[model samples]
Target: MTENSNMQSDLQKDKKFQRDPHFISWQWPIVVLAAGCLLYYLIHISDHSLPKEVTIHEAIENTNLFSSERSRNTLRKLTKLGPRLAGSIQNEVHAPALIEHEVQEAQSNAHSSQSILLQRQKGSGAYFLGFKLGFTNIYDNIQNVLALLEGSDGNHSILINCHYDTVAASEGASDDGITCAVMLELLRVLSMQTLRLKHNVIFLFNGAEETPLQGAHMFLKHEWAKKARIHVTVGAAGSADVNFSSADACDRFVRRFHGRLVAACRLSVTVSN
Candidate 1:
């Protein structure tokens, strides 16, 4: 009888606990939190997926400068002359002829006001000497393509430099072709602008860059390099990753930009051997 009484007491305790209002139910709270999070995520994704609007001027600038279609077309033309290695027949002859043809095409356009000129510099011939082989000399000529946009203030000039020559067996589409195409497009765009610029812009396409930067060394010997105050020089080191690295002038260069359209970071690297 006592055992039966104890069982009845335990049963009553269980029933009381089950009916207590203090015992919190988590089901509704969890559902609400989950729903809130899902709604927030949907809203965030929709906000980011929407298209951005641009001004008319920005649209014009986009079409005129750095047009992907135009650049790609130029790249195609460049790659047609495959493997423009330094001192090779393709680099020495075909590349120069192609550049000249493009220049002539640009000149023939009735809309542009820039002057296109081709300057040829004699390259330092290659030589190899060893015990197994005697000294051998190979002659390779350097050609520099220049497009001049003379500004009202002729004292200052900006040099845009890119090499047309490539390493052995490289089509150089990214190595330097892109840079040359960009320079050409920039010249075309600048020529179309009605407003006169303050400083002259010179486009310099150097040859034989793969062979000890001989083209640049030769350019320094020109009369234009002597008189002109070279404001900026944009060159490529055979890649699409656009990184501007100026030792002391980076801060000054950064000060010229005023928008958040692109992020720029200054990095210092240290190496140990």
Candidate 2:
């Protein structure tokens, strides 16, 4: 009876093995795919890292002397909001609150100086024309934060815009969180400048940019856009080239700078010549 039981047990074990799929074998393919994905990610990140050839001056143009410690502070504040996707909870509630606070603080600073004329709208609820994002059935909502450093000459206004929204999965520390922080720093610096500006500079922090550039499209509908002689947009993940569509416009802008060429990384500016 003992021997018969032992043989029966062996037979049951063999049947179990036959019924089970090769789970260990299946794991090997998954492991290979994971490894391939990791390798690809590393390669891509290395390629898009900040360019080594970029100079201090070029970096300054992007960072504005790192805004003397305020750069990191503003960046930290924005990153604390985490991924700000349009219609997400962060986008709907937290991001706007934080941005409103920051803008109020910056505006207070802007108001401190009697030398410059400044006007700001803390939260402008502008609706962008809705469109589906990529393969997803998501529609964009426009939420733009605008401030104008109104120059003495209002005949020609320059619009400087940047998107503050991040993609669905990213922390957006680099994507546009940095841009927002830089804009704050720029606002701070420009406010402190004693020299009078030649043209009005509109500071626009746009939303819904991660989805189909809805914020930008809607920006064109603004009355200020019609009066803008120059439009400067600050958003390029890791590019350094300053692309000018028209050489004549570039020349005129350079001349306006009084022969000072400020190297801008990933900055595109359009000016009517």
Candidate 3:
């Protein structure tokens, strides 16, 4: 009986040892290491992720709002409004609201001392003309226009023209809106002149250069161009590529601006002559 009782006690002791959780082989070290590694990785990732470039028109294409494509489509879309008869031929013309909005915005960021209103009426028949653009302000008012007008006086009278208002309903990427931008850039660079200008520059931001040189014609009604000896009408040759420099258009512009087109914008020349 004593031996049986002792055997039962030994069995109970064995069962208790087996059921104790702490007595079993544990993996606390590995579990702790895994948690610590996960936490370390999370902290490292949080410290390493943050933005680099900032510009209003940097990703011009990526932004769907005012890209050049939008400008072109806007103009094409507006032709349905009604036909604007340029006397002989009738074509659809866009309104100036969108361009006006853009100009207003540009004025806010510009540094022009004299911002002016450029108005060119419709050109009469057989009108040949020239245009020059400098940097233009985005946001402006009537007073800004008036101030630009005030700065027109020089030794000789000349034309100061820009396509201020864009074509109505246009995503107007090109068709002279881009020209207006070129004009603004010109304005920014040209204002550093300490010497008096030779001609009285008549600043004209024609509402409809795309329509029919309307503003240019309006200004031409006066004897200013003839008096100022306006020999050249400068036009930008869009953009260029280094690889296709031998293309006809590029080659022609290079020769044109340097030789006979003295009144044109001087970009560069190929030959030493």
Candidate 4:
């Protein structure tokens, strides 16, 4: 009887201890502080925060700069033409004409120091996918719209490539039309008097990528291909691939380009704010 009573007493004491207000009071402050810290971290320290929305006036002012509005407009215009499959009228004739017009406009407005040369290249080639696949693709009269921006050192150049063609039944706005619009904007910006280049830049708007890289293969046979020391391919379906002659050159170019991109993003954010 005595032992059972002692056990009951102990149980009651433990229950009291478990329910102690002081213990909870001490823990509550700490938990609140932790939650507050988490909220602060999420709101201020994280890069995942949404960007501030830009007003119409701010967008209009930034048109001379890399403008999202203008890019979207260009994309809309391209996508409206429908799927530009390789060998289709949209891909071969209409798309090339539109891109050529844009490049020509940029060339006309280019700075005196910069000389923009536009080329509509037609060529034929065969590409073997791989030994394992044993697939050979042949192309005839594949068109490539190339714009060369001559710099001080014209002997060496960098090639920026993106295909304008898309798979059949797809609008391809995101797959390549957006990228084409971006390239157009980049050409316009680089042609400004304020910017000067040491090595030439060639923008290649390939028309037969859906035909499995036929346009690029055709470009390899072109005279301009000899001057290309580096290749930068931007595709939505894949990551950006930069190919350079040397690892050191690749590292230097990546670092420089990344820094400039970050700076541009910050500047855009500031302007929007």
Pairs with steric clashes in candidate 1: none
lDDT tens string, model 1, 19-86?
A: 55676577988999999999999878866665444333563565344354565567678777887877
**Model 2 pairs whose backbones collide:** none
Residue clash pairs of candidate 4: none
Task: Judge candidate 4 against the unseen true structure and give its global Cα lDDT, from 0 to 1.
Answer: 0.79
Better of 3 and 4 by TM-score: 4
Ten-residue segment with the worst summed lDDT in candidate 4? 264-273
Q: What's the lDDT for all of these models? A: 0.64, 0.64, 0.41, 0.79
By summed lDDT, which 10 consecutive residues of candidate 1 come out lowest? 264-273
Off by over 4 Å in 4: 1-64, 238-273
Q: Give the TM-score of candidate 2.
A: 0.57
| Top lDDT model | 4
Candidate 3 residue 129 Cα shift, in angstroms, is: 14
**Stretches of candidate 1 exceeding 4 Å from the true structure:** 1-66, 110-118, 123-140, 231-242, 249-251, 254-273
Estimate TM-scores for all models.
0.61, 0.57, 0.33, 0.68
- Please tell me which predicted candidate would have the highest TM-score against the true structure: 4
User: Could you tell me the TM-score of candidate 3?
Assistant: 0.33
